[model samples]
Target: MKALVFGADGFEDLELFYPYHRLKEEGITTHVASMKKGPITGKHGYEITADIAFKDVNSADYDIIVISGGKGPEKMRLDKDALEIVKNFFKKNKPVASICHGPQVLVSADVIKGRKATCWIGIRDDIIAAGAQYEDSEVVVDGNLVSSRNPGDLHAFGREMIKLLK
Candidate 1:
């Protein structure tokens, strides 16, 4: 199976790294995509090279999409191409895993209106404003979408994502 992970500068270090590596450990081929080519830095000072650019992604070519949280999503959600990628994945009903601020992209994509989801407490208002039912749990799996609250919830987030993939 193939997975595409999306993020940009200031992404939560654990939120992106944990899922990317965990999915790879599960034998799933995973690629990272960002707004531009080259290295994307995390809020914690770690940097990762993006494998593809948002403009070049084709959601149908992959089995799942992962969105990482952080200040990154604040800028990422404003990108039309980024928002479209999230929408296409949801449109196809493929499994989507997002953590923390990552759900901001889903909000921009306008795909989580009625879905149950969780995200950083700071964005709970935005999630509800987008019409999604916000939960305070560590993780929430609503249909093909899996969401988590923050870095502290990465374990449950990754576990739920792998479970969904299976």
Candidate 2:
């Protein structure tokens, strides 16, 4: 299996790197893609040099796409390219995993309509407003989607993601 991790900038480091290493350990090739080509800073001021730019990723090349959450979501939501990359996965029926404030982008992409998911409590209204159903669970699995509340739920998040990938 192959995975796409989308983090524009200011993403939570644990949110992106945890599953990234998990995929690698399981022999699932991973690609880190974002809007720009160089280093994208994390919320804690850590720099994650992306392995691929959004312009280079094709939905057909990955089996799953994981989007991390952070303050970046507020700005990244307005990025058409990031939104399109996410929508393509759902349109193709590939699994898409998002957490925390990450729902902002998925909802902005218009791919969450009628699907059940979870996100940061603050964004519950945003998810609902996007035409998707919300479950107040730490993790909710709806079809090809998986979501969790925050970094504290990363354990469940990674487990659920691995289950779906398998």
Candidate 3:
């Protein structure tokens, strides 16, 4: 399966690397589509170079879209193009998984208005306002959408994603 992982400049390092490595173990092809092509620093001061530019990735080519979050969401949620990409993928019925503050993008996309999802506690209100039913569980899967509370929830998130990809 082909997966598109989206991260802007300050995403959680673990959120990005863990899923990327886990997906590879399942023989899934995952691409890092970010706002820029060069190295982007993570919330913890780690830097990762993106593999593909967001504008260069087409939704039709990917099986699922994963959006990771952290300190970046506070700024990323305001990006029009990124929001559009989330809406487009959701509208197409492609699977989507968001972690930490990543749900903010879905909220901005206006796609979570009635979906059940999980995200970091601080952002639950934002998710609810965006039209989703927020859950406090470690992981929540509503149809094609999956989410987790934080980095510690990565195991469940990765397991769920592998099932979805399979």
Candidate 4:
């Protein structure tokens, strides 16, 4: 299995790293992609090198897509290529896991409308505005999409994703 994780500068470190490592532990080959190739810093000062650039990602190559939240989503939502990638994952009905501000990209992709989801409290209004049923739970899994409020919910988020993959 192959997984694609998308993030940029200021991404929540745990949100990205936990799932990345968890997926690998499950024997899933994972690739980190950002707008640029090379290292991207997290909000907490940790850095991760992106394996590929956003322009090079083809959703068809991935079995699952992970969107990690933080300040990064504020910028990634404005990226057409990133939105396209998100849309393709949904279009293909592949598993998608998004945490915190990550839903902003799904909102931009227009795939969560009428779907149940969870995200950071700060973006609760945005999630509603995008037409999704907002849940305040630690995690919400609707069909192929799994969403969590923040790093605190990573355990449930990762568990649900792995369950779906199996």
Candidate 5:
């Protein structure tokens, strides 16, 4: 299986890396995509290289998409190509795993409406406004979408994602 991970500079360190490595442990081939290629620094000073640019992504090539949290999504949500990639994932009914601020991209893609999901407490209102039945749980799984509240919830987030993929 193949997975696509979306992020940019300022990504939450654990939120991005945990699921990524977990997917690899499950034998899933994963690629990181960002606004551009090369290294992007995480909020905690770690750096991960992007394997592809957002505009170059072909959503059909992957089985799942993972969006990392932190300030990265704030910029990712504004990228037209990034949002389009996200829309395609929903359109195809592929698994989408997001954490913390990650759901902000889903809101911008306008695909979270009526979906039961959760995110960072700071964006609780945004998720609700976007029409999602916001939950405060460690993880919320709605169909192909799996969402989590914060880094503390990464274990539950990764567990639900792997379950969907399996």
Candidate 6:
């Protein structure tokens, strides 16, 4: 299986790396995509090199898409290419895993409506306003989407996402 991870500078370190390595452990081939290629720094000083640019991502090439939280989604939500990639994933009903502010991109893509999901407390209102039935749980799985609150919930988040992958 192939997975596409979306990230950018300012992403939460664990939110990105945890699921990424977990997917690899399960023998999934994962690639990171960002606004540009090369190194992207996390909020806590960790760095990861993106394998492809957002504009170059072909959603059909991957089985799942993972969106990392933190400030990166703030910028990702504004990228047309990124949003389109997300929309295509939803259109295909592929597994989508997001954490913290990651759901912000789903809101921008107008795909979170009526879904049961959760995110960072700061954006609870935003997800609700976008028509999601927001939950405060460690993880919320709605159909093909799996969401989590914060870094503390990464374990549940990764677990649930892998379940969907299987």
* TM-score of each model, in listed order: 0.98, 0.94, 0.93, 0.98, 0.98, 0.98
Per-candidate alpha-carbon RMSD to the true structure: 0.8, 1.2, 1.3, 0.7, 0.6, 0.6
Kindly list the per-residue Cα lDDT of model 2 for residues 1-166, writing each as its tens digit: 7888888678988898888888898999998887777888898887887888777777788999898888767877787777888888888778888999989988889888999999999999989999989988889999899999899999999999999977
State which candidate, 1 or 5, has the greater TM-score.
Answer: 5
What's the CA error at residue 93 for candidate 2, in Å? 1.2
Give the whole-model CA lDDT for all candidates, comma-separated: 0.92, 0.86, 0.83, 0.92, 0.94, 0.95
Alpha carbon deviation, residue 126, candidate 3 (Å): 1.1
Output the TM-score of candidate 1.
0.98
Q: In terms of lDDT, which candidate is strongest?
A: 6
Residues forming the 10-long window of minimal summed lDDT in candidate 3: 72-81
Report residue 89 deviation for candidate 5 (angstroms): 1.0
**Model 4 stretches with alpha carbons more than 4 Å out:** none
Ranking by lDDT: 6, 5, 4, 1, 2, 3
Q: Residue 97's C-alpha lDDT in candidate 1?
A: 95
Per-residue lDDT tens digits for candidate 6, residues 44-153, read 99999999999988888899999999999999998999999999989889999999999999999999999999999999999999999999899999999999999999
Q: Find the 10 residues in a row with the least total lDDT in model 5.
A: 85-94
User: What is the C-alpha local distance difference test score of candidate 2?
Assistant: 0.86
Score candidate 5 by TM-score against the native: 0.98
lDDT of 1 by residue, 22-92 (tens): 99999999999998889999999999999999889887888989999998898888889888888888888
Could you tell me the lDDT of residue 147 within candidate 5? 96
lDDT by residue (25-134, candidate 5, tens digit) is: 99999999999999999999999999999999988899999999999999999999999988988988889999999999999999999999999999999999999999
